[model samples]
Target: MMLLPDAEQLLANLTERMRSGVATDTAIVGIHTGGAWLAERLHHDLKLPLPLGTLDISFYRDDFDKIGLHAQVRPSDISFEVEGSHIILVDDVLYTGRTIRAALNELFDYGRPSSIRLAALIDRGGRELPIAPQYVGATLALPSDKMLALEKSSTGKLSLRLYDKNPMGHEQ
Candidate 1:
């Protein structure tokens, strides 16, 4: 079994980096369930002025046709003006880069931001696109058939879960 990364320590490192790195007009936006959770924590940790925003990129995904729709698709909410705002886009894992691409498309729909930075707790390398995270907690090389995910406990603690796909490409 793969050891889970230290969520609390990773957040501390990310916070330390953002202290000097974030611009004055920066806004935090999380990519969905897991990302939203992280953004909430980061926003509180950094004491950001702007409200934390969340994006549900279910509609903007390229593989929507093949995978169909998600059961719970929450509407994206960005209260602040995105124009000229610097955005910190948060995610639990960085894999194929498809999610970030979809997130970019959705984010632009709100308005154009001055810049956007990608942050992830884990970067499991298997990129099908040219996307890379600006801030990452750790990078791990996993087999193509294995998938990594973040799971939050009832008390709001975080852990990593690895699922292995069988020879037939079915998740175990």
Candidate 2:
């Protein structure tokens, strides 16, 4: 596993993209796990006025029946109004796009947004849905057996890595 770009670079790119769009009253929302990790770092960097929102797509996932329930489920947290708010959704990686689909469903539960843009640390391509990330730190192309993960150090640093995972669901 190798460390890719650090959080500072990622935040720079994200802020640039958000600036180009000129979104007003922007809010940041991050999916649980890896996305949440990246979001925390971004919130500090961007200094968004609204509180950071978190979405756990576990229950909203389409593969819930096949993947079963995750042992650790973190609830979605969005206290402020979402309607007409410019929401910048953050995620660690953008791949099959299923997670974003689930996240959108969970997001509407809070309220509809004026615009929903996505930001990701890595875009691995191979999207199953029509989703796309407006801001991406890097792009990677890996084999089907390979997977990506983002780790956050206690000192508030972000690291990206590639790993191997069994797509068959036969290996844990």
Candidate 3:
């Protein structure tokens, strides 16, 4: 397996991208877990006007029937009005594109945003959908059998891991 980039380096790259394009009116929303964690940091670093928003897209997933429900499904939270607001949707990893698709559906449920720009820490290309990120911290290519995941320690340190996707599930 290839060495994963340091989380700090990836965050620095993401910070630079956001600093350049994001405007005052743009709101930040992160997809659950890793994405939310990344978004929280970005919101604080960028000093965005609105509070950080988090999304739990378990219910909105296209493969909900096949995968069933995830155990830790949290409610999607967006305190600010979404109508006509420019959105910066953040995620830790951009893989199959389904998560982003679900995130979009859940976001629209709250309200329609003027625009949504995708931001991701890593882009490992295995897209099943036509989704692409506007801002990417790092990009890597791996085989279909291997899965990349973000790990956040209790103390808030971030790391990455690789897993083998098996027929039953994942082998970590």
Candidate 4:
């Protein structure tokens, strides 16, 4: 099912939940692409203590050869201190958990934070690894043959849409 939320509502929900558990000095970090989109919104809404950090996990993926390099490779920016600081890792969607895994690897390369909490806009179940989002905008139980995609306009607007899979029972 397509259980998407309005961008404003999703932003409010995420900010509220993240503020509840996040330490006073917590930092916000977003995974590349979709995650970064959500993070930008949350950062503006929440007024986080530290500047936002954007990470590109494409180069850090274990299956890099299979997926190949993404067209865009944004640098992971966390110029501020990381050790002993609480971090909120943001992503657009949570599915197989491989992206989160790859994100963790990239995060460590910078510095080890005291703790890292996950935040996702949507959680579609199909976890290849044991990972969960600490804060979620919505949860959807989509059919295996369907796919969920998050898109953002150049103006920084965000939305989610569903696409039917091809004859091969995979997202086209």
Which one is best on TM-score?
3
RMSD of each: 2.6, 2.8, 1.9, 2.9
TM-score of predicted model 2? Answer: 0.87
- Predict model 1's lDDT versus the native: 0.82
Q: What would the per-residue lDDT of candidate 1 be over residues 1-172, giving only the tens digit for each residue?
A: 7776777677777778777867557799998877888888888888889988999998988877766777789989899899888999999888889899999999999889989999988888787889888888778788887877777899988777888754543111
Error of 3 at 47 (Å): 0.7
* Predicted candidate 2 versus true structure: per-residue lDDT over 1-172, tens digit per residue: 5555665577567666665653437788888888877776677666677888888787887876777877788878897798878888888878898888888998887788888989987788988889988888878786667777777779876776667785644111
Model 1, 108: alpha-carbon shift in Å? 0.4
Most accurate candidate by lDDT: 3
Estimate the TM-score of every prediction.
0.91, 0.87, 0.94, 0.87
Q: Any residue pairs clashing in model 3, and if so which?
A: none
Candidate 4 residue-wise lDDT, 105-159, digit = tens: 8888887788999999888888889898889987878787777778887777777
Better lDDT candidate (2, 3) = 3
Between prediction 1 and prediction 4, which has the larger lDDT?
A: 1
Give every collision pair in model 2: none
Worst 10 residues of 3 by lDDT: 163-172
- Local distance difference test, each candidate: 0.82, 0.77, 0.87, 0.78
Model 4 has an lDDT value of 0.78
Give, for candidate 2, the lowest lDDT window spanning 10 residues: 163-172
Which residue pairs in model 4 clash with each other? Answer: none
- Candidate 1 vs candidate 2, lDDT winner: 1
Give the CA lDDT, 0 to 100, for residue 97 in model 4: 90
